[model samples]
Target chain A: MRAHAQLIFWAVLVAALALLPPVVGVLHEPFYVELVRRVMIFAIAAASLNLILGYGGLVSFGHAAYLGIGGYAVGILSFYGMNSGWLQWPVAIGASALVALAIGAVSIRASGMYFIMITLAFTQMLYYLGISIEEFGGDDGMRIKTRSQFSGLIDLADPVASYYLVLVLMFGTIYLVHRIARSRFGMVLRAAKSNEARSRAIGFSPYSYRLCAFTIAGALCGLAGALLANHTAYITPDFMHWTRSGEIMFMVILGGVASSAGPLLGALVLLVFETLLAGWTEHWQVILGPLLVLSVIFFRTGLAGIIPGAGDE
Target chain B: MPPLTLVFEQLLNGVQFGVMLFLMAAGLTLVFGIMNFVNLAHGSFYMIGAYLTLAAVQWSGNYIAGVVLGLAGTLLVGMLVEVVALRTLYARDHLDHVLATFGLILFFNELVAIIWGRTLLDFPRPEWLRGHVEIFAGSRYPFYRAVVILVGLAVGAGLWYVVTRTRLGMLIRAGASNRTMIAALGVNVRLLYTVVFGFGCALAGLAGLMAGPIYAVLPGMGEMILIQVFVVIVIGGLGSIRGAFVGALLVGIVDTLGRAFLRPLLATMISPTAADSAGPALASMLIYLLMALVLAVRPEGLFPSRGR
Candidate 1:
């Protein structure tokens, strides 16, 4: 009965999201359209993170680097007079994948906290690099003067068109992630996460599997980055800031990190909370900080865990 | 501007920076080594110490009295936090420790901002340590910096003695090597952890007080230095004081030298304009690049402690 309800709950959520823009339009609340766009962009990033953090059990504290790399890929390419989404998006994904491969190759050699710190160090290095490039606006960052041209099939300048594009991409990502999570490869990844020694005993090398997962997640996040750049029509080094990475991690933990749907839930809740609290007062962090502490202490399974009749499994 | 004099002065600067890093890294290594805990909020003590010193100096009209009170205050705060918040996280995973402590960081940052405004706090050096010393061929070094180096070294030596030459040191070592055996031997493990934590907090506080005059004391100041300190510990080897000391000096020297000379060196290879833009950027990245290199070559660090 609970499983049936869980399925129904998810289906209703997707239907509601698909109908959000029209409903908001009827209510004359275009602001919510923009808000939901931000949520979906982060949802893609958070879902990618869950692949490594939740299932693979790699606590990559620097996952936001992909966001920056993806953004920069679009920003830099457009600056160099390439605005076609076909070329720009692939390069963004490719660049992030390459960097991920490099970071993962070195970082996977170490285990536990060491891995976390190394990943952080690498991301900080990238953040510094982003600020150092004078042509790319240096510390101030650059504005994307024009959105990536989608070859006239879809006009990115139109808010409605861009909104639908993000929505479709988010659904595609959710489907792809769900399939990956339940596949044979995901089983091996989870096995390694739970018992590396035993997995190695069973003749599976954890390194290649982990490195593969890390790269794929980075690629997925890079796609999200491309969409984010288009949505905001601006990219900054701040996208890869350490705190941004922390926020992404918090989203994964908040949503429950159990399934693909959890990150989407987390992203929406976080943005809504931020929006509501910021409206109330500027000193929202003072409250949010303690709330995070309380959650970590009490909500081990996170927001998804609170669902009625949801078993431990 | 003479090359030799410049090199000598930069070396002194590097040593001074390294000594300061040693102060922060020592406490960090101790906590990690003995308790098997990753305390991200260790920097909070540093920030609090600086703030307390600033307040006490303004109130008491005596620098020495202010420094003493500042250290004591931070020590107490550190202990109180350990008892109140961190005690529950002792057996939790590092992720839990990270989240809880990160939350503490945000809380402390906002609280400080609310109390003391977001502006920088200026701390003037005492008159005795104000002038410069002509130590090299017509090159003058600040007396305040010289004193900072001396104090850091003195504290480093003191920590070495306490860790290696005392009974408490033995228990600490034993605890790091085998917590179960020490607990079974009826050692007051709980008291020891608290004491060790307090001592580490004092060390961080001392570093903060010393840094107050050299750098602006502001909210989140601890975080600025915390990353470099982590690099020191990683390069030196976590859980090893000697490694931290060596790593700190190496980092300090390399960082100073890179900032001073990397641009010019790059200029020789590339155009001056290209070098100018790339110099500061590369200089900023030098330490992280060094850390990556070290990890690639020696994953366990240069001085892994016994059994870890």
Candidate 2:
């Protein structure tokens, strides 16, 4: 919780992520590169979710829909041979933003469990939409023939290039969230979350602030989704499932909420734990499930709280 | 147009589906209303109930007996989960409840898979219950489905009497309205909550067992209907029993009817090929769209609980 502690935490995490590739090269564990790339991509998503869910107090259970939408944006485009990142990535972000606009416009009016369920309903709606589209293989999903292209500046097909790309984006997202959390906009959003009536009395419309936060989070998560598609080179309706959203939410909570670096650490720990557990046994969920329950019960401060300092971000 | 008899059959199917949903939603709403706790794992009870029935029926060779034992087992499991994992979570944030219950879901699912070998299990209907019955001058219906309807209606009636007329029901209503105040009075709110939770689990188990004969019973079966049940509770009003029933029936009927008629309806307006493709997609999305529409008009639901 200390300021310097968080600084050190982010610094170490960035360096470690930045330096994972060569280490993988030395260890001859090429699979780990892909695994950590996934972790970083989701780290971007979890951090974005923390932006709304932690900082603004909006529990949008359908966050994964943006992932699906973003993935599909790149996917459906690539299906038509538009593998260019310039077109695909912006379309991914924009489409997700537009969908978020529609969903948030309707569901943000309600708060608490209603908000949660409504968001879930909307996401499931999109999941069905994804299912009904047969051209891209519907529920079976589609394989990405090529990762997004960058007009010769970069190639997502290259593993190291993709790794660094994800790393840069993840760090940017976390820093952007940290900045937003300290801004005037974040103060109003947090105020509305803590006391809606008081914030409204103070003339800050909670609706607009929360909607803005929700859409921004959705757009950011969409980028993560785009990366997720590139990382896996496949897109499926499964990406939009409510449980996937729950997993992302878990990353935010497991990492710690309202902290700049919490989502990054959380994604790293959870996915790594999963990888290790899966390697250990076929019934890895048996252990992971109870562990999640116990952690939610006991780990109020999350992995971030384990640090010596306990008060900062 | 479809034959009138086919329409009748679909109507009956819709009601049967509605009846099962009511059973699942009833317990959820009671717990949701009274404890203000959201149990995402409620569907686990349904799954366990179905698995228990499959195992018990095989062991006992009696359908009714298997169902009874399964319900009892589900009740016990519900109590154990309530005491061991959930009691402490009552005072925590809903997010904590979501996380914890979600964990329970994962644990129970894998545990069930471990025990049952992860293959889909089927529960056979009793020989007598599998016959068809003439319900009207020309209409014949499946007896098992009729039985499901009867059981659901009977339970709904019993629930109505209990909540409206009985002393325990009075206490449940009081606890739902003011848990602290009920505790302040001589009532042991804790025992009441466990009882409600267990009873709710039993209802869910009953629904699950009955559904086993109708749908494929599998480890994660609970979650498939669990979302629909949540939609029912949401549309009916979170804590209100009347709302749960109405909402359940509405969702069930709309879903069934939509799947049945949407293709024909769309075909009449568009190309048959387009309708064929679009129908299934629209059908799957029907209930969710209904929920969205309901929320748009009445954000608190049709029968919002008082004293929330």
All candidates' chain B TM-scores are 0.97, 0.98
Candidate 2 lDDT for residue B30:
88
Candidate 2: tens digits of C-alpha lDDT, residues B129-239:
988999887989999999999999999999999998999999999988888898989898989999999999989999999999999888889988888888897798888
C-alpha displacement of A254 in model 1, angstroms? 1.6
Off by over 4 Å in 2: A308-313
What is the C-alpha lDDT profile of model 2 across A15-48, one tens digit per residue?
8888989999999998989999999999999999
For candidate 2, report its TM-score: 0.98
Q: Per-chain TM-score of chain B, candidate 1?
A: 0.97
State the lDDT of candidate 1 residue by residue for B136-216, as single tens digits.
Answer: 568999999999999999999988898889999999999999898999999988888988999899999999999999888
Top candidate, metric TM-score: 2
- How many pairs in model 1 have backbone atoms within 3 A of each other, for residues 3 or more apart or on separate chains, i.e. clashes? 0
Question: Which parts of model 1 are misplaced by more than 4 Å?
Answer: A308-313
Residue A236 miss distance in model 1 (angstroms): 2.3
TM-score of each: 0.96, 0.98
Query: What is the iRMSD of the candidate numbered 2?
Result: 1.2
**After best superposition, candidate 1 residue B275: deviation in angstroms?**
0.6
Q: Distance (Å) between predicted and true CA of A182, model 1?
A: 2.2
